[model samples]
Target chain A: MERKWNKSSLMGWQFVALPSALILLFSFYPMFQSLLLSFQSGKGTVYHYVGIDNYIRLFSDPMFKQAVFNTLLYLIVQVPIMLLLGLVIAHLLNNPKLRFKGFYRTAIFLPCVTSLVSYAVLFKSIFAVDGILNKMLLSMHVIQEPIAWLMDPIWARVVIIAAITWRWTGYNMIFYLSAMQNIDPSIYEAASIDGASKTRQFFSITVPMLKPIILFTAIISTNGTLQLFDEVVNITKGGPGNATMTISQYIYNLSFVYTPNFGYAATVSYAIVVMVAVLALFQLKLGGEKR
Target chain B: MKKLTTMVVHLFLIVASVISLFPFVWMLMGMTNSSSEILKGKFSFGSMLMENIHKLLDMTSLGAAFWNSAIIAIIGTVGTLLLSSMAGYGFEIYHSKSKSRLFGLLMLSMMMPFAAVMIPLFRMFSGMGLLNTPTAVILPTITTAFMIFFFLQNTKSFPRELLQAGRVDGLSEWRLFTRIYMPTMKPTYAAAAIITFMNYWNSFLWPLIALQTQDKKTLPLVVSSLASSYNPDYGIIMVAIVITTLPSVLIFFLLQKQFVQGMLGSVK
Candidate 1:
């Protein structure tokens, strides 16, 4: 039943139109302004149009390249592990015989709820040169001396990846768990009656069922990891010669920490937009078509 | 082997929980210890909790900062829910190809990292002479694409028959939304309010950029700046962290039932 468009109806449309227009204005205007600013170059308040120069400079800049590599590395390495672990744990939790489900769920989910400052401080202390981790490793005969988890380049990246995975796996698991609740238990029962192993049921039934939400979380996680800043900044300060610097952290440093290179920073920001758009497009193509 | 695997998963979950809770435990212990004892990594309670609390109160304008955070969060959350839910209701009920394309474009904005736009956003506010205003921080955030996306997703399951019935009863569109749709969507609104409040209360970046004066600083920014000092007092920082984290946790605890209830509607 279509409601006829009337005066009050038109007024409601007008009201909705105004807010949507304002939202589009704020969201698009700054983005376009940033695009314009990216073409111009200079120190604070003095600038000139330098079309393609900022892009060229970005291409040539070693730091930007390193940031790109680190962000991509984190994206490639961390996303799959977190998603798989989330799926596995979620499947296990979905088991009918699993006990203490609330305790397990809350325990795993607590990491993300911890304030960012505490997590940073905690990680820093635990990974310090003579920290508890090293002491444990030494006494356990796992290491000859100490592993400077944050000071070394490779180990620092590993630690950051581990940190992200630890904090987010449970969060992603919650999404899967919530999604799992919507599935009919009868389907799993049918699978078990057909003599499907739990592992077989997971791969064939659960994974296929969760494909869309999995893709949604995956894309969001990609964007999140690509823009990773807080943990890196707070934990290592993107330190040891920018070994762990992410695109977002680099953009932050360019904007605030170093000289205010707003133009190049905007260009770098567009790089993130481009990457996320590409990945999202691919995800939609692969996952969105599913019913 | 199955039993062994179950045991391993249990062990892993226990370890993760300990690691997760360790910082909170440490922060509490730090609050109860002298600064020297904290730096020495004292892991137990001491005689210094009251002293640390007194020092925190004396040194910083914690009361004012807390009030500022509350005010901003409340206003921001309320404004966001009203405008965003309105738009979500409008779009979902009135879906067209054009509006769908516009929604797609809106989701694009959500993916762009906030840091990339930080400078231009700061410049825009400064140019508008709005620096140091809570409005400067609250306005841009209130109409977030993420929240809009959330509302739109939730609104998809909204019963359109309610609107048809309202129209049949000769209700205006706005009246239909306010009377019928809004009441039915109470659970969604409650969940959105909690998430939005937590987000605003924990917001750090934009406030740090826009708010310049001492009185304007929010709790997280104040705690961060305090922690950045040359001889950072671990005891006081611990106190400040506790203060900063309490409101979000409290809000979560209060609204968690609604939150979990709404999650089923959300993930679809």
Candidate 2:
């Protein structure tokens, strides 16, 4: 039995060895290296240790401040609206009596599957000065002239928020819909028998039951928004005077587009990590994990 | 009142679906129109589809970009599924205290933002003389922690009785894994394939940094440069967009059932 146990344990290690080694090299090792890099200061490959200076520089750096503000703006405005829309849509579609269920679900889920570059191209054209959105507003007599959506600072942020919400709402909805399946249907039946309306039951039962999944989506969206890059890079390029620049974009610009101050870039990346970690912890605290 | 409420629900769903699908319809129309027509917000199909395709092919190396993306995505997806699934199975089935601790550490690795590690990873690759290579793009992502977690979650429902039975039948551990465990996990494999393929194909940032040469660029990089040109051509871009978007959509439509099931398994 001792020999058999040893054999199986050896097999277990063999199964795990390759993947664990890869992760250690690619993920864990690089992580430590970046942490070390964050303490050094230089452009490109040249560097010398400057402990905590990068962190200190972050406080007075106007561009970093603007990027953080813009990222926070998206997190505060977009995530809630998207989650709410997703939950409502999921609740409505969860109705067994709803018509064209598959069609509606598939259509709504389609956006998440689109390549980031494709959708960004589509959105840029749609919101261009002479684009369809302005044309539609003009046709409806809502505006006398075209709105330069991507050129104006405020509207540029609005377009970024709208784009993120459009792409991700259905993704969060899938989580809600799946979690809804686990709720005992007879509870809703019982609620209705006790003279509760649909709205009442949704608020009291469904919301409470789906709280954990909601928390999951919230944390995920928080992390996603903090690391916002693709849309801003593709759509606005943090243009119209850095109006829509995100921290992730700033990091990219630092390393690749500019003189490649890799240490400062690593510093900015750590800021994002800290922000996401704090927010995630807060969310878990509030949501009260069942586990 | 019941009739009114039902009407309201239908109206909401219809409006949302229209909004969701409008970009796709517009993209298809844009592909067929001239650049000026697209800029002018023309909604109908024009006679320029073939012309746009020809121009796109002429202007850029779309064929090469597509080939690079395909090779990277295929190799990355297959390698990720095989290795990560192995670790996941070993961790879950061969339960040990130390292994569980290691698994927890792996989960923490997933939470670290890729940007934080990008500079160091780039330095490491450059040190190894792997810069501007597709292997740099493929190697770091080949054994993603999230994929391992996904497989671990799905493996929870896998029956242990089958393993015991295979053992009794004189099957070796490796043989049982190859001949039985793998074949039985078809749905999970399909789901992982679709997700991994889409990820590798659509990946922009890491590839953008890793690959420096024009010939080495992927489709997204080419499309990005084209769009940023001082005199951007909407027609040609729409063609490129369609090409970039089609494969993932096709895979999604084909494997959607298993995809959703796999997602459901994860969140549960």
Candidate 3:
């Protein structure tokens, strides 16, 4: 029996050995090296042990501060709005009496499947000076002229936020919709019989039941927004004087676009890591991971 | 009052669906319109579809870029599903204390932003003389922590009785895995394949840094360069965007049911 137990354990290791090795080599090793690299300052390859110099520079760097502020603004504004929109849409779609449910779900979910470059290109054109949005507004006489959506500081941020909300609301809706299915129907029946309206039922019943998923989506969206790079880089290019620049894009610019400051970039990356970790912890505490 | 509420719900859904689908319709129309017409917000189709396609093909090495993207996405997806599923199965079914701890550590690795480790990864790839190669892009992502977590989560639903039955039939462990476990997880594999393929295909940042040469560039990078050029033609750019977006959409259409089921399994 002991020999048999030993054989099964060996078999287990055999199954996992290759993948574990790959993860160690590619994921963990690079992570450890970056943590070490964060301490060493240099251009390109030349380096010395700087010991927290990069962290010190982070406070003084205006670009870094702006990127952090922009990222935080997105986190505060976009995530709640997107998640709320997702919840409302999911609740609406969950209505058993609703028509064309599959069609609506598919259309809403299609945006998440689109290639980032394709959507960024689409959004950029849609918000261009003579783009469809401005054209519509003009025909409606809402604005006398085209709003340069991607040119101005405030409008550019609005465009970025709108683009993200458009793409991800459906994604979060899927989570809510799926979780909502797990809810028992009799609870809603009881609520309805007890003089509850649909809106009231949604608030009291649907919201409480979907708490775990809400928390899950919240943390995931927070992490995603903190590392928001692709949209800003592709659409605005953090342009109009870096108005919409995000921390992830700043890190990209530091390493690839500008002179290779590996240490500083690594430090900025850690800031994101720390921020996400703290936010996730706080969410879990408030959401109360109750089964 | 009931009639009014239903009308309101339907109106909201119709508006949302139109908003979601408008970009696609506009893109298709733009493909058939001239550059200036697109800039002018022409809502109608024109006689420029073939002309735009010809111009796109003539100007860029789009065929090579498509091939590069297809190869990387296919290999990356297949590798990710097989290896991550293996580890997932091993950790779940085998049930070792140390292995679970290791799995927990792996999950933490998922939270580490890719940007944090990208510089070191790039340096390592450069040191290995793989800077301009697709291998550099494929290697780092081939065994993603998220995929492993996904598989691990899904494996909770996989029945252990089948494994015991396979063992009693005198099959080797690896044989049972390949012949029985893999075949039984078709829906899960289908879902993972679509998601992984989309990720690898639409992946921009790493591939942008890794594949420097024009011939080695993926479709996204190619489209980006075209869109950014001085005096960019919106018609040709729209064509490129359509081409890049088509594959993921096609895969999503084909495998969406399984994809949703897989997601349900994970969340449950």
Candidate 4:
């Protein structure tokens, strides 16, 4: 990039300046404004900075606590299961002798193309008390009667978990499949020569090699789940008594659904920012990214 | 034993594939059935397709919703590609310490969840008197850090020799970027375009907040509203959801390779 005029350094700014300005205006400026709003109190127009009262209120807020609990429940219960299932499927499809790899890949990956709201609505209908699932179970004698799936609190949570897992497992599988392809086949050959079983090879070689990707997907899924507004908002509407209410939904409720409390909602939103930062750092350390 | 193991693997894949593909099939079947028939677990096609389309058209402005989504997705995707790529090229090609620090700051923006910025953004847009408009929905996401990251990662593989030769040919920096750089990076642009379009198309939360009016509502918003009704007609919902989901599906199938490449670019 060295030039006679010493112009390249200044020239690069011309390209980047507009986009940098836009990101600053939309992303950073609003982020700071949100942070400022979190510290203020009162609704709509009349508001003033009230120290950390909003932060203190967050501790005692039942709805906020419930939302956090439901979000963590999804992250703990759904993420590992989805990632493991994705890894297993990717491993299976990575087999050279496996037939119809393209078909399987496409079929599984097809779910990713679906919009979150669309799939959530579809899953809701499918799991309704008198819907296709209950009908199938009844015909097969697996259940003696139709279960009101979205009515029960526990089952409603399960339905949300299932819906998220169903939509995203295949999406994660694509990542693992590509990463697995990069692993040297000769490494597996050597491990087999040394009498490592298929299961052993997967655990030792494949899992270890895909650590960074696992960490990546885990963080992405965690962030996504924490902001889990769409599925819950659409599927259950945070119903069965806020059983599946995520923090994002709570933010929406605070600002829009309920009386306008953008101040407190911004406070709640900051909680997510802190949690995301903390969890991502924790995953990076746990995944042993030093190597 | 090994043969049995392989058979079991095959069976497992079959079940997984069926589960993955079943809803799509169910949605298609639902398109052809009435609401109550679908409720009673009828899984076969019926003669209600035309009726459902008729009802959907009568109930909502389906055409307007589709048009809104198309406008937002197309314009937003094109703007995102251009702006993000320019920033990416500047950061990578220049390779300065100050630029790297600035890039790091921009990357931090990626971690700022939309919820955090939603309230302020709403206020900002409303203050500008741009509520219920496509610009509000399109502006915030037009130059995302994630898309910029994608371009930067892809740019690392770009050949520097071309830039040297172009410079020798008296090509200005912007002209070189336009004439030489863009043509060589068509695949990257395509990949970025596919992913960006799908994102804008499928985006719900921001658009839901920004676009408040009915006629201005995008397809996802319309489908969501339709299903949120007290006594939703499953037939109408089926039609709406199918219409909402089809564009991304078609784009995905058409440029499946670039879509995958674009996604992979993020992590790499």
Of 1 and 2, the candidate ahead on DockQ is 2
Candidate 2 segments whose C-alpha is farther than 4 A from its true place: A1-7, A289-291
The A-chain TM-scores of all the candidates are: 0.94, 0.96, 0.96, 0.97
The segments of candidate 4 whose C-alpha lies over 4 angstroms from its true place after superposition are A1-6, A289-291
Kindly provide the TM-score obtained by chain B of candidate 4 when compared with the true chain B: 0.98
lDDT of 2 by residue, A240-289 (tens): 89999999999999998998899999999999889988999999998995
Error of 2 at B61 (Å): 0.4
Higher-ranked by TM-score: 1 or 2 = 2
Candidate 2 lDDT, B1-268, residue by residue in tens: 9999999998999999999999999999999998888887888999999999999999998999999999999999999999989998888877677888888888888778888888888999999999998899999989888888888888898987998899999998888788888999888888888888888999998998999998999999888888889989999999999999999788779888876765454787
lDDT of 1 by residue, A165-238 (tens): 87788779988998898999999899999999978998888999999889989988988887788778766778
The local lDDT score (0 to 100) that residue B43 gets in candidate 1 is 60
Best-performing candidate as measured by DockQ? 4
DockQ-better candidate, 1 vs 3: 3
lDDT per residue as tens, model 3, B99-195 = 8788887778777888887888999999999998888989998886777777877788888899889989999999888988899888788888888
Runs with alpha carbons beyond 4 Å of true place in candidate 3: A1-6, A289-291, B262-265
- Point out where model 1 deviates above 4 Å: A1-12, A130-132, A135-141, A144-146, A286-291, B96-98, B164-171, B261-265
- Tell me which of candidates 3 and 4 scores higher on lDDT: 4
Candidate 3 lDDT, tens digit per residue, A7-89?
68667887777888888888889888888888988886897889988999999999999999999999999999999999999
lDDT of 1 by residue, B70-115 (tens): 8889999999998888878766777655666777777667876777
Q: How displaced is residue B214 in candidate 4, in Å?
A: 0.7
True lDDT of residue A238, candidate 3: 93
Error of model 2, residue A34, in angstroms = 0.9
Instruction: Compute DockQ for each candidate against the true complex.
Output: 0.43, 0.75, 0.71, 0.84
> What CAPRI-style quality would you assign to candidate 1?
acceptable
